[model samples]
Target: MVLTDTHTHQYYETDPVKKAELMQRCLDNGISRLFLPNVDSTSISQVMDMVDTYPDNCFPMLGLHPCDVKANWKQELETIYAAIKETKVYAIGEIGIDLYWDQTFLAEQQQAFRQQIGWAKAAKLPINIHCRNAFDEVYAILKDEHNQELRGIFHCFSGTLEQARQIIDLNFMLGIGGVVTYKNAGLDKVVEHIGLNSIVLETDSPYLTPVPYRGKPNESSYLIHVAQKIADLHQTTLETVARITTENSKIIFGI
Candidate 1:
């Protein structure tokens, strides 16, 4: 079965030697697709370069991540939009609110989020959101601005079942990753009630590594562990989990 990591930062590895080794490991483990989300103006070139090296296995997205949103966010967003116009990105992503880290840029984060959503709508591409500690704020924006033409995944989702339902109702998929594997994550309850079709698998790597590898730098190859955990949570075989998640990923990314 083919397993797809719908959100990953494999491109974040600057050391070419290490990056190649990690990517090969992923390919060897049947993780065929890796989608790279843009953080800001700084990482777009790096992401594009990595996709260039393995065009078939990697896809690039363009956006300004919430954490990166600052007073100069408008200029940064202009750069992101220009890049999207120049290249065919897989999606508009890694963009959303993050209140956990700092609230200094909360207003700017909301503006950037709404701006990116408009870019996604205009470009006719899906989005990959990176929300944390701002579910209510993000949901409120979505509720007001979301349209039938707007769709994407809530990457690294660790929210309640009601939130999951709201996301799905808005025609966006929930991105499930290593967080579900945490003993006290509580995502298992959400998954048990929400069907797998509303979900997609991701690693968010070089971060959020699953059990046994938690606290270490994550890689796409470790996606197997995340998938296995989901399979067990659903009482199904790994192959079934891989197949369905991959299909769900295709529906979201159109890849």
Candidate 2:
């Protein structure tokens, strides 16, 4: 029952005691590997600290999140790019365009996304995308930039079967997370059309907590629920989902 949380953000919890307890909970729940995605330059240190504390369990990524893109996005990207060159990051991610909250920086977000994609290609790393209300924009960039050298996951995917197929066609995996367990999220229906090989599990923790703990803060320990939900949707067992998705994660993250 080895589970891998392909996407989670645990850098915000600064308390050492709380961090140790959280790591214990993850281990107890059989979540042995946790991939931490960077939000922006501000989050780099915290992410590095977490990875340092649990070198065996946690891995880090380097990127500037779409929502974090602003007038100074170029400077922010420079910081992330420098980190990518210096640090041992697993992916270039948690990056993409988000128009749901603000459309003011859409162009800037797209450039940041593509620039990061170039970095990932040059560095031979996968990407962890965070798309929200900008699938068309993201897909357009992917279509133009993707090649044999490009690969990654559509993190926290909650789209239609058509979109899922499109992502798969581009050689990217669908990152299924807590949203699949939502009462009316429609992700289960999407899952029915796609095989487990095209999917990977994530928690997006500190957000999108799975059922039975919907209102509470999400943690890596809750990944079992997401895996269970996918198992139920596919009419398969939890062990199968865990094994396949963990393998799919290794394919993407190379860990």
Best by lDDT: 2
Model 1, 67-174: lDDT tens per residue? 999988999999988899899898998899999989999999998899889888887899889899999999999888889889999999899998999999999999
Query: Which residue pairs come into collision in candidate 1?
Result: none
Candidate 2 vs. truth: CA RMSD? Answer: 0.7
lDDT of each: 0.90, 0.93
How would you encode candidate 2's per-residue C-alpha lDDT over 49-110 as one tens digit per residue?
Answer: 99999999999988999999999999998888888888899999889999999999998998
lDDT score at residue 7, model 1, on the 0-100 scale: 93
